[model samples]
Every structure is written in structure tokens, then in C-alpha cells.
Target: MGDLKILICVLIFSIKTVHSTKSKPHIVIIIADDLGWNDVGFHGSNQIPTPNMDALAYNGVILNRFYTLPQCTPSRAALLTGQYPMRYGYQGIPILAGENRFLPFQIPTLAKKLKELGYDTHLIGKWHLGQGYRNATPGAHGFDNHFGYWNGFMGYFNHEATGGNMVGLDMHHNDEPVWDTRGQYATDLITEKSEEVIKGHNESKPLFLIVSHLAVHTGKGGVDLEVKDIAENNKKFGYIQDERRRMYAGMTDELDKSVGDTIKALAEKRILDNTIIVFFSDNGAPTIGSALLDNTGSNWPLRGQKFTVFDGGVRTVAMIYSEQLQNKGTINNELIHITDLMPTLYYAAGGDVASLGKIDGINQWLTITKSEKSQRSEALINIDEARNVSALLTDGGRYKLINGSTVFSEVDGDFYGETGRDDSNPEYNTDDILHSSVNILLRGNLTQEKILNLRKQMELKSCRKSTIDHDSCRYNSVCLFDLFEDPCETTNIANKFPEVTERMKSKLEKYWSEVKVQRKGFLDPNANPVYYNNTWYPWLEDTRCHVGDLRTILLS
Candidate 1:
């Protein structure tokens, strides 16, 4: 009788524990800025040690086929609204600081969607959506609190951004400039703030937190490579010969620690067991010679850099961690887009996907957690009419149709390295980066055996150079590649596979026809930070003239 009672009690407790932790898991996303494909340890980059990210990735599921826009702002917009940036005219170029352009007020962000479900939502860093108007701020976008910059790139120490040829303070605690912490390093500051938020959260309500870090992304102007503690940073990355690369390595290390620290906070708070954590870069690194922000991170063996439609710019290092996942520590090659995040996480939070309305995103919760077949078959990479640049992904992403010059001149079609065109010894020098997931739960030979099998089955050949000429690619031309065969997109197969190119073109046209073109925002003179006590603020709010007129001008 006593044994029977004890067994019943144990079973009841187990059921309760499972239900509490798995059903209403806290959703967290850590967004790394301008991180390269080969920047992570799991991606086989021995240059920078990212053990924290590696440990989490090894414990979780690594997203092998994740895709995003070639730029940060558009990707962020896609993530927030669960729709293609082309729908709102954000496909062309990122939102420039001091521009009147912003995300349309009609669309609800991921924060808003979760907030509707009674989650305590917060955005801890980098709100690049637009902050010209109060309505466009993160607070108006559904975050209960916003502690970060509004522009694209800013100084890591000073928290100042140079836009419209003028530099000004950009950090904020909601709408006000965070002047007091001017000299502080943004990576450390952002991490501390995230830890603070997590520690203080009420466990009764599910938390939706986005830590959009500024680490690994080069800062504005002269202070390009921002390191937290110079002495400590130098000591760790002493093996790196070049000063620039060494600085970048240090920045990456800080980001790795940030990840560990954040996970630690959650564990300490006892919410980690019930938390669903997703981490990925906003876009690929710029590398040495790329005209896109001139960062020092490397995307070696993957052609092109940031602001290009190539895999180096689109595909990112990504992973998801959760105790609730049925198959942890695996690689998922699902056809996922940045837009998928909103619906995927919404469904994970027990919200109805139907409530999200007619967004372009498909709910990928099951595809991620249960290892179910990817429900999505195609993704519209982008249709940037402004830059006359675009690319279309089709046939379940086995093929990609490129319609514009992927800014290949800067990235050099066929020329690639950590040193850009130098073609020196590159990182991840292997022919392919094998899908990097080894279930650490297995012991000894089983782990090694599984790793070997995984390497063979999931190997992806990232070509170093191409036979095709790219002179035509410098103009508005077409290129098609079977991404499965040539993941680096070296060979332009438009002529060889004319029918496939035509089909992909037709699919792109359909999406292009449906685009609701967004007007580019002009640099408002009033937006000069010099006007607002040398701090970046919503200058339009203070204007006595008609706000409608400015918006109408932009629309016209």
C-alpha cells in the first residue's frame, strides 16, 4: 500500500513539472550584429573561440539552412512584422538614420503579438526600425521597455551614430538619451541590462525578450573595432597576428560571454528549464574589402559579404535551445526565413497563428521542435527596387534566382578571404563546412561515430572560386544556381538551365506584382542631432508644422 502511494505521488509530480515548464516557455532571442558564417566554433572557425555559443548549439538544434535579408534593418523588419520587407518597400536599402521612413503603424511587431498573449515583452538593444516619430519607437511597437540605440550603427563606447554627416548620442532608456553611460562599452552594457531584466521578471507571466546586441559589428567612424576591456581583450586574442582581426576576435569573445551570462541568469532564475532560446546573426559579416560598413569579421569560403544576395550575406549561423525540444542537438535544414520567427514563436507561446492575420510567415514551431518536415517550400529573398537589386529563392531553396548585382564588385566575384581579395590562408579552409552538431549526451565512440556519419551525410561544398565570368553580373542581369550543388553560388547557370531560370523569374514576378511600394524617407533637416541638445531624439514631434504633410511628401 505504501509503495503504491509513493509511485502515484511521483507520477503526479512528474506530470505537473512537465506541464508547467513545456507549455508556457519563456521566449528569448539573441541577435548578433554582422556575425559571419565562419565566425562561430560550431561552423568550424578556429580563429575565434565561441565556446558559449558552441556549447548551447551543441546542446540544442543548429539551423543549417537559415536565411535572412542581406541587410540588418530589412531582416529585423521581416522578423518583427512576420512579412516580407518588399511588402513595405524595405527591400531596397536599410532605414538610414534621421530619415522620416519607418515601419508602417498598421503592422504589429512580434513584441505586440506576444504582448497580446499577456507576455511581459522587452527589447534590450538595437531598434533600427525607425525613431523619427514617437509612433515608430520600440515602445510604440509593443515593447514595455526599450534600452538601446535607434540607428543602424553607432560607436560602442560613446553610443554615438554618424548619420547625415553629423554624429550624435544614440543610446536611450526608452525616448531619452543614455548620456550617463556614454563611455561604457555597449556589449557589456547591453548584457548587464538583459541580466537585470531577466533577474527582475515576475515568473508568473511569460517573458518575451529580444537582446539585439551591438557586439561583433564595427562601430561608427574611427572607433571601428570596439572592445570592452582592452587589456583583457588583448590577452585572450594574442594568437591573432593582425590588430584589426584581433580586435574583432575580442569583440566576438565578449559576445560569447554575453551568451553564457544570459543563459546563466536564466538558470539562476530557474526559468531556463522553461525557456525557448533562439540565437542568430542579423546578417553576414562585411569582411575586409566589402563596402558594407567595413567590419573585420570573416565569411571565408562563402563568397560575397553583407549587402549581397550570396550565401555569405544571407545564410547565418543560427541555433535554438529548449528543454522541450524532442530531438535536441541536431541540424535542421528547414526552409526558414526571418519572417518565420514571429509566427513560429507565437505558436510556441500557445497563440493561434490565425490571429497573426495574412502575414507572409508560416508557423515553424513543429518543424523546429518536433523535427517535422518544413511546411514552407519557397521564400522571397528580396526585391529591392530602389537599388535595382533582388533575388528569389524557390524549389524549396534548392535553387536561387539572383536578379541584381549582389554588390559583387566590392565583394569580388570569385575573390574571397578574411583579408578580402588578398586570397591568403582563409579560415575554415576545408572544402565544405560539415553540419556541426554532435549530441554530447552520447559517450566516447558513439559521439565520435555520430559526428563522422553527420560529417559525411551533411557536408556542404562552399567553393573558393568560380569558372564563370562575372563582368555581366556587374550590371542588372540574371544568375541561377542549384544551391544544393553549389552552395557558394559560384556558377551562374541561367544559360544552361533556361527553363528553371524562367520558372524562378515567373515566381519572382508574381511576388513583385504584389508589392506595396514604400516611399523613401528624406533626411529631415530638423533631425540633425545638433538641434536636440546633441542627442538623437524624435525631432519631428517638436516641429510646429504638420506631421501629415511630411508623411504625405514621403508617400508622394
Candidate 2:
């Protein structure tokens, strides 16, 4: 009897200890579609209301210099894999049905790692990284539960493709169709499902829910006079209409409310205090002159909008609400990229993330929790071939970078300057399109002396023979500039401060080469076709019939 009692006591103590140590906090990542820095109240927007997001920022750490890949799919890919989009195959947006480009299976994701550590992974919203039909589906990647669309954008009223039906593009609730229903908005549906996911969870384990909403992207062509009329009289028509701006603003308002509802649900369940809620945009706003939505989202006082490498195209608003870190109402200007989220989450959970494998993102928990200004010393930014851009050491709130392609040495990639806007692209009015309030510095500033020294530094840290090879790569080294001094990217100080540019360029090259070696590309050659045969996918399924035959449906 005595021996049995002792054994029981030991077992009870072990059980208690395990429960205490394994009390991992829940994590919620909320990503808005094509949202801009000036679109939210947290960033001083008086036109559109975003109370929930404002509260999140007010009670958390607002990352003033947060960045993301310039495009949607690429940003998602980078955030998921903790690597540059180019390293993987998802460099641009995927529109075709059954596209196979996705983050490699070998690359560990936040969902996969958290699940392995006994957490319930739920993805509730847009999964544009890849279609849900192919091996690109969220379920195949690492998410245990996925309820959203498989493509870039979808209609708000009907869950169908933005305008009409598109094959394999129906709204889904985990490999199942969300039956066609009227009076249901896509944003509300996403929020509803997200709330359900949080409420329905039985708490068998810790949770990691991603509430990725598709609101504020394209407001169904910005119709609906009540919503569209808000922007009255074509207020500064650089690219879009006033009505369209109003419609987009309305969408943002709804998105904010949706976030509020979700937050309310978490608090109702008493999980708000223990959970870490992260809110950020996937990428910059779409800058196409005719696109109704992007024109409405003024990135304001920043350079460029969407698709370009300028600050507006890549820079975004990011905030984290967590009680453990005691991060509230503080603005952090330290340079941090989207890739850093995965590793930071891992560290926050207090789990052994090292054993999972090497990742490009460094754990930035200190920067968030402690409000340490000097946490991040350097960071890099890359967007396909437009620009071979990189940022070197951050010194006292000042950011220095070497911007210019290796082969396109003379070619300036400044998307936010007078030369960049006026000198190129005849189709669109570059001045009207370049809405940035800042200037950009470029190649002319880097003199021959600085260029030579930079070249020598590149020679030492050369990646010309490394694995990540690009046929279009230009000169290996270049000049450095304080973006604040020259946001237009016109000045080439390589001659004056050749040594500084050389040193920074060398650092960038070494880092790029190392990343190239580790991220072996993954490819999927499957053709899973679209859900409905319509105008977008005319080759396959089409829901509407015209003249007794299938014909293209034009959007006015």
C-alpha cells in the first residue's frame, strides 16, 4: 500500500508539471488584403474608420517600418516559408487554374511547426499563395483546417470570382463549396467563419488561427452608390474615381468591424489575454491606373504603390497585441520584414525551434517585447528583376541602402522619383501614378571611386558562382544612400562614399548567396483546372452561355 501511494504521488506531480510547462499561448495572425499604410485609423486616417485595428495598434506594438514582398502571392509565400519569394517559385501572382508553383514541402511553416508541437492549426480566409485544388492547397501545405478562396480576389455579394464564374474559384469551407447564397458578403463570411473557428475550438490543445480576410481589396468594382458615393466628385483622380475611393473606404470600415467581432469572440472565450494577435497587410495596394480599388488606397507620403519596389509597394502597417510581451501603444521604427514572423512566433511559444531546422528569419521577440531599438542591425528586400535592392546596417533611426541591379548598372529602379515616373511608361501618366510624398536616390550619386571600392568588396563576397543564379544580374557592387536624404533614389554616392557603398554591397551579396544555397526550389506540375467554366477560364468551365455558345464576358 505504501509503495502504491508513493507511485501515485509521483505520477500526479509529473502530470501537473507537464501541464504547467506545456501551457503554450494561442496565436492569431490577421492579414488584410491590399491594405495601405494610410488607410487605417492607426496611421491617422479620418475618412475611413477602423476602430478595432486602431485599438489593436493602440494596445500593442505598431511596427512603423514593417515590410512585405511587393505582390500578394509572393508576400504570402515569404511569410509562410521565412524566405524570399524568388528563392521559391512564387515570384509573381498565379492566375491560371491548377498552377503548381508553391513553397517547397521540405520548407517548414509556422503551422507545421506549431502542429508538431501539439497546436491546432486553422486557416480561415484567402489562401492566394496557391490554389486550393492543387498540391498548393492550405491543407497540403501544413494547415489542418482551411476555409477560403483559392485565388487572388473574389466577389463580395456572390462568393464567385470577382465579376463572374471562374473554374475552381468557388468559395470553400475546407475542400467543400460554400453553397451559393445571396445577401452574404465575402468579408462578413470570412469573419463569420473565423469567429466560428475560434468559438468551436474545444481547447484540447493550444491554437494557431490565421484570420486572413479578403475585404478592402476590390469592392466588387466599387459599385453600390451608398458605398461608392462617399468619395464625392472625383477628389484627385490620379488613377481611380471618387466613388470608387468611397466604396473602398466602406470596405475597410467593414473589415475593421469584422476584426472587432473576432476580437470580441476571443475575449468572450477568455483567450484574448493569453493569445497573441498580429495584424498586417499582405502587400502594397494595386497601382494599376484603371484598377478601381488601388487608386482609392493612398499609401500617402511614401514612394510608389504595389508591384514596384518603392516603399509604398512593399512597406505596410504591422502590430502585435500580446499580454505576455506587455506590448501596448508603442511604435517601433526598427526595420523588420514579414519573413521574421515565423521565427519570432516560434521563440514566443518558448519551444525548441532550433531543432526544426535553419530558417532565414531571426527571432525578433526582443524588439517587440523589450522595445529594444537596436535589435535589428540589417535587413534585405528583393523583388524579381525590377530592382536588385538591399538595405545595410541601421544606425540611430537612419536607414542606408545600395539600390541598383548588377547587370542593369546604369538602369535606375527608382519608381517614386520624377525621372522614374516621367521618363518611363508612356501608357500611364507617371506623375499621377507616382503618388509618393518622398524622393528616391539612384546610380548617379555613386562616383567612380566609391564604385571601385564597392566592386572590390563584392569580389570578396561574390555570389557570381553560387547556386542562386540570375541571367539578368548586372554589376556586383554599387553606392549607398540615406533614403531620408534621397527618397527619389537619384544620387549615386559610390564615388564620394565608395567605401560605405562597397561595404554594404558586400554584406548584401554574402547574405543573398547564403540564402540562395539553402532555399532549393520546389515545383508541382499538376493541372487541376478551375471550379466553374466562366469568362476568366474560357478554356474550361463557363457558367453563363451566350448565343448558344460560350463567349467572353466583358466587365464595364
Candidate 3:
């Protein structure tokens, strides 16, 4: 009788443990570096075939109005820390190698918060937040395991920055320089490591994996490093004419394949259905005429590109895939910000939101899963500190106001270099493609017509437009646009509605002041020890590099 009772107790305990493990969803966040709004196939890109990304979106919910910061460092910083980057002194700037600027360890990151809830956190690419200082790397920031480069960008093949102020091998595996990964393309290497992590993940605990790809971002070798072989891959991308654009297409294709492989790994591990995958670009594409590396990523139909506060720079491509999502093969046109991810994922993992302390991110699990409308009806602010430009999108991305100017104006052309929008193409069937893809993925559980009806039932809610001209808005004047009516910021109506303009302007000013005060007086990057030492890797004290000597630093 004693032995029988013990056996029954053990069985019951095992069952409860399995149930607990299954209840916690695994989180996979795959971020693309500098991927344009039109870079992927799902976004109506005729040049690049991003089938994997398309498939994921098809089988999940597309965040139609997702917004990010104007630059990589700020966007990433906000995504992880759940605060506006400006609040932390990131301020819409890339963390240049050797700079002491980094996401401070004191701040609670998404990884840290999730890890506290018994999840295994792993960051498997681009940790550009900071590098020179100790505890500035991903490992120091609550990630249990991290593999990839610490700098913003590196040569895809050589794993080194080519001709930058911090040119050196930037690849690392858990804070240590990984020299053996030289000659391996960064995308492939990251995918391989990510699969290993997935396959080897302990199923008893939930997993939080961040596969941040460096693809689509211009490598250290510039346009040449954008793709493996421009000449060879250009043949595959015969549809794309321009050499640089063709290279961009090739790189995007590789990124798509990487996404597909990641999903496959998750499915093989039997964790796909229990995992929530969030995919998005850090920011908009860096098109030609922009000061940043012009990879020729087209943010067409939208004005401006990287470094600007325009929708083209701040608005981005984003999607969330999970079996738990109530709306699959559908677009959630809510105004979702990057900061929301931390709280959303934390809540989905059953973590107490109140315990996260003061964070800018809000729990959008219900909004994301279609259980309820988005609670975020307030203005979403985007600031470019370097340019002193700020944009505000309010009322769920319908009304837009900008307090600064944009460098690039809207361009009219097809991917084949044909001038003007192709009227024949008309409206791209994003819904149809997503529905079909999801139907296939779900094994025809949802018919095309059923999916169409579902979309209609959740018809995209309309928002009012506020338009303003770029030229007139350049010198601190407010530019207003009705983003819903004009997805392209073609017209500005700031003069039409004086009261609305004043209201938004006042709000923008108040928000900016609040953010400025949160800088904590750590505003100057030049004051860092690395800037004085003139070394990208301040931890490498033995390296022969000196202050005020750019030539020696580059050579070394």
C-alpha cells in the first residue's frame, strides 16, 4: 500500500511538470537589420522573394502599423529596455565601435525579465547596443548565451569591419572573440548556431531566442559586401535591373531562407506550435541619397529614408506568429511600437506586468492575439536626435505630425527602374497571399473565402489624415499628414487644421522635454574612456592604438 501511494504521487508530479512546461510559450524574436518596407515579398516586393517571411506572416498576424526608431541602436535599445531610446541617451544614433555608449546593465531588459520567470534567454546575433565597456555586451544584459558580433555591422564573410573607425573582427560567442567563424557568411553562421540552440534547448524550461540577422544591412565592404556575389546572384535576380538593387534582392533572399530555416528548426523540435515568433526590421531601408550606407532599399510610396523622422525611417515591417494568435492570416492595423514587445511577451509568458517597474512598453497580448482592440490610442513619438527631428503618429497611426524635415523625397518607379507607379499592378493582394499561405500551413482548415470573410469582419479601421509639405516643415514648422488616406506622405494639411496642429505640436514638445530630462546627464559619448583611448576594443588594453591617431587605429 505504501509503494502504490508513492508511485501515484510521482506520476501526478510528472504530469503537472509537463503541463507547466507546455503552458509557457517559447519566444523567438528575429530582427532584420535595415530591412526596407518593400524589401520582402509579402510587402509587395516584386524584386525580392521572401517566401519564408511571407509564410510566417501568412500563418500569423501582420502588424500593419508597427513603428520603430529612426536608427538601429535606438530601435534596439527601445525594443529590449521598453523605454524610449532618448530616455537612455541612445538618441537615434548607432553605437560606433570603441564608443563607451551602451545599454546600461542596470536597466531591466526583456531577457532579464523573462529569465527571472524561468526562461532560457539567448541572443544569437548583432548586439550593437554597446561593446567597449565591461558588462555592456549581451551576456552582461541578462542573456544566458549570446553568439554573434557586438558591433553595428561587420563584413558578412570576414566577420570584421572593413574601413570604419572600429575596424576589427567583431564576432563573438558569449563575450569572447570568435576568430574561427571567419569566411563564414554571418547570416548562415547565425542560423546554424540558432538551430543548435533550438535543438539543444532544454524543454523543461521555456526558451527566449533573439536571432538578430545582419543581412540587408550594408556590410563593411559597402555595396560589394551586400550580397555574396553581385554578378552571380544578379542572374537569379534578373527581374531587378540596377546592380546595387540586385545585390539587395540577393541579400534579402538569403535572409528569407534564414527565417525559413529557423521556423523549420522550431517545427522539427516540436516547439513551433508552442512558440511565438516576432519578426521585424530594426528600421526602414537606407535608400540612395541617404547619408547612411545606401543599400538601395526602396521605401517607395513613403517619403524619406534612414536618419529622417519620416514614416519611411521610423515605420517598419513587423509580424507576429503563434498558434495562440486569434487572428491568423490577418493584418492588425493597430499602432504597435517596438517598446511594446517586452511587456507583451512578458505577459504572454504569465509574468506580472506590475513587477517590470517603470517601462514605456504596454502589454498588448490581447491586442496582438485579436482578443481585444489595441489599448494604445495615444500618440507614438519618434525622434532623430542627431537631426533634431521628431514625428508623432496619433489615433492609431491615422493622424501624423512631424516637427522636422526629411532628406529624401518620395520617388516614383518600379523595381525594374521604370518611372512612375505601375497602374496595372493596382492594389497588391497582400490579404489573398497571406490567406493562401495560411490555408496551406494550416492544412486547409481555413478556406480562401472564409479567410476573406474573416478579414472583412476585422475590416481595417479608418483614421483621419493630416498633411504638410516637406519644404515648408524643414525649419521646425509642424508637418501634418493623414497617414490613412495617404500611405505616402504626398500632401501636408497643417495649414488646414490650425487647432489640431497646435495640439499635436504641444504634445510633441511636452514628450520631448520629458524624454530629455531622463537622459541622466550621460549625454556625451566623446567623454567615454574609449574615445580618449582611441580604440574600438577598450578591453584589449594590449593593442597598439593611441588617441587622436585615426590612421594607426584604422591600420591596426
Candidate 4:
């Protein structure tokens, strides 16, 4: 009887151990809002110290060429669904009465997919994908525990500026709007919450945490630098002329400290070995207000700001730090985007995400885990209708196409107005005449003939919206440049290679057509954000890129 009892006890213990071992690895995704590719220490910024982010890069797989959508909501939508933003009809940041349109309710997000796999998913900080307005719900999507604001920007100190401010609406902790407060700074507060979630997770099951930080996004006016140490070092920090960058740097400093805290917590909990942590930015920086923000930290040499389709707009800082990962100090330049996150995390956590349909991103697991290069090259297409500009990158390496040079030359603001073309002498590269001509045309100083010729050349062989669409004239002039050859995008080889231009245009149009099918149909059918045919406009009143307003928000 004693021997039989021992055998049963041993058998039960073995079963429990096996079950625990089968549990998935803990996964955490930390997304920084509106951070430039050069903002963090890993990217070689000396103005602000980012020890935590730099540590991740040194110890893990640093993806130097990770790509994301040009803006926040679209990027979030893509990240959550593992699909291109357009596929779900959320190509633009849909807005109605200051409230933006969100990702469609029907799409299965990463939260939902992970939840289906029996992992507890939690989102801490910034939830901008969709607002919870009775019909459109944040909790309804997939996150088991959600705590954050619904809007894109908010005041770090003055909660009144952004509706209810810190205490936002549509927040849920298992279907309850629980007010969770922290006395520390906002960046620290966010990181603190992430640690709590990590430590409180069930030991028997794997965990998935989306630690979305609002640190880098703009707030009130100047930077929100109220930290004790930051104020003392005001002189040294004063080099950053804009109070916004100083405050932003303060926030970033705290954010780095918080990362260290989280790492410490993970170590204390003895789960560091099994957990995978990823850090990435939503988009590029806004080059206004704080010169320190733009001058020292932002992606320089890359033309165009946040809203434009240039490299500065969508190329982001991405790193995956995990002791379990085999790759370290390896840079994977193959094309990868925000949409790939869902499927990549799903696969990493031992779930079968192959069953998920039509994810635009390729699985970067091998590249990240084994330090192997990408098997299939991937490309990214970015569009800014208001700017009348479009760009396509062949994977994340070399070769880019910039379309609609005429509009860029004539009308678009300084953002992408300079096309390296001398409008005065079309055949010459003289900044005095040709470049000056472009400036004149943009300033409304050019003659009718000059404008007509510019329009004609810009429309050649490019895709058009429609015969009546006034913007169609701005549709399809292409400029090709090898990024490795010219990271500044100075030289245009399109004129020399007609065949390459045609091939790229065809490919670009095909991609656009496929994504267009994801549109919400037409605008304003029943007066909701999502109108007829699935078109959802932006939440901000005007979709126009306003650097001033953005700076004000960042400061707040």
C-alpha cells in the first residue's frame, strides 16, 4: 500500500511539472509613441541618455529597419490585427467631432487572438486604436485588462485639457472602469503598472502585456520637465532650447529608469529567462517647437516630417530583448511593419497564428531568434493624400519611390516641397535656377506655362484616382534612389531607368488597390464615424498637419 501511494504521488507531481512547462512564454510589447528612429540611445543620440532602451539593444536583437504606419492610430490598428491598416478600412485616422474613428469592431485584434489561446492579455497606457463610444468598445476588441486614454494626445499635468485627462473613459479591468492611480511621474506610472501586471500574472499560464507608453508624444507646450533631478540640471539641459524637448527628455529619462525597474522586477520574480520584451516607436517625430527634439534627437538627413511618406515618417526604432532569443547585436534590414507584431508574438508564444488570414508582415521569428536574415524581402507603401505624396520602399533596405513631384514642387508645404528639382531650368541641377523655380512656383510666382509643364511631367505613367479627381494630376511621377547609395534621397535615377519605374508603379498600384478594398466604402452615410462603404474619417477636426497644435499637445 505504501509503494502504491508513492507511485501515485510521483505521477501527480510529474503531471503538474509537465503542465507548467507547456505553459507559453511570457510576452511583453512596449510601444513608444511618436519616437523618432534616432531618439533612443541605441540609435546614437547623445543629448538624452536612454540606458534602459540601450541595454535592450545591447543584449537582444536590435531591428534597425523595423517599419510602421506613418501615424499613430493606423499603426496601432496594423499592430493589433497583423493586417495592413487599409484592409480593415482604417487607412486614415478617422475623426468626427474631435473623436477619431477606430479600428472596425469585426476585425480580430492581437488581444482577442491571444486571449483565444488562453493567455491573459493586458494593455497599459495609450489605447488609440478605437474609442469606446457605446458601440465601438475598447474592451470588446481583445484585451482582458485595459487601462488608458482613448484619444491620441493628452495633457500630462492638466487633465482638463484632454477631456477627463488622466481618468479617461472606456477603460476596463475585466469590464470595470477602475481608477488606478500612481503618485510617480506619468512615464514612471506607466512602467510601474506594467511591473504590477507582470508580477501578478499566473505562474501556471504565460502572460502577454502591451506596455504602451505615452512618454514621447507631445503634451501641453514645452517639455513637461518637473522631475527633481531634471530641474537641478537645468543649465546642462538648457541646450535643448525648446522647453518641450527638455520635458520630453525628462520623460524619456524616467522612462529609461522605469525600464530598469521592470527588468529588476522580472529578475526578482525569476521570470526573466522565459519572457520576451520588445520596444518600438509608433512613428516619426514632429519637427516644430523644440529644436532639441528635432535638431539633436529626431531623424535628420531623412527628408519630410511625421505625416509625409518619406523615411522619417514611418521608419521606427525596434528592438527585441530576450535571454531566450538566440540573436544578439544583429541588425535585420529586411522589411517588417507594425502589422507583423501580432503574428510574430503569436508564434513566439507557441500559438498557431498561421491560421490567421492575410497578415501583411512576414514572420520575423527566425531573423529575431536565430540571427538569420529575412528569407523573403518585404516592402512598405506610405500615403499622405493631403500632402499629395506617396512613397514605396522595396523591403527595408535600398530603393524607394517618391511619387507626385509636381504637387510637392508646387503646393505641399515645406514638409516635402523641395524635390531637388530646379524648376527654372528643368534639365539642370542648379539650385539657383531649377530649385529656385520650384520655390517660386510653390510661392505662386511661376508662369502658367511653367505650372502646366510641371503638371504634365508629374502625371506621366503614374496611377490616377479618377478623371474628375483634381488630385489625380498629382498621382504618379516616380523617383527611384538606392537608400544605401543615398540615404539623404538626393539623386533620382528614375529618368535613366524607364523599365524600373514602370515595374515599381505597377507594383505600387496593385498594393494600393488591395488596401483600398479595406476602406469603409464612402463618407457620411448615417453620420457615425464609420460611414457608408466603411469609410471612417479622422477624430482630429482637421487632418491637416499642424505642427503648432502638435507641439502644444506635446507640451501639455
Per-residue CA lDDT of model 1 for 190-262, tens digit only, reads 9999999999998878999999998888896624897867788777776667788888888888898798778
| Candidate 3 lDDT by residue in tens digits, 10-101 | 44334322334348999999999888876655554445656567667666788888888878888898899888876766665576665556
Task: Write the residue-wise lDDT of candidate 4 on 285-311 in tens digits.
Answer: 655434212312365435445654566
Top candidate, metric TM-score: 1
Name every residue pair that clashes in candidate 1.
none
The ten-residue window of minimal lDDT in model 3 covers 411-420
lDDT of 2 by residue, 225-281 (tens): 123223442342223324556566677767877877787667545566568889999
Residue 394 in model 1: lDDT = 83
Model 3 RMSD, rounded to 1 decimal: 8.2
Please give the distance, in angstroms, between residue 279's alpha carbon in candidate 3 and its true position after superposition.
0.5
Better of 2 and 3 by lDDT: 3
Please, what is the whole-model Cα lDDT of each candidate in the order they appear? 0.77, 0.58, 0.71, 0.57
Which segments of candidate 1 are over 4 A away from where they belong?
A: 1-19, 407-409, 419-462, 465-468, 544-556
Full ranking by TM-score: 1, 3, 4, 2
Distance (Å) between predicted and true CA of 266, model 1?
0.4
The most accurate candidate by lDDT is: 1
Winner on TM-score (1 vs 2): 1
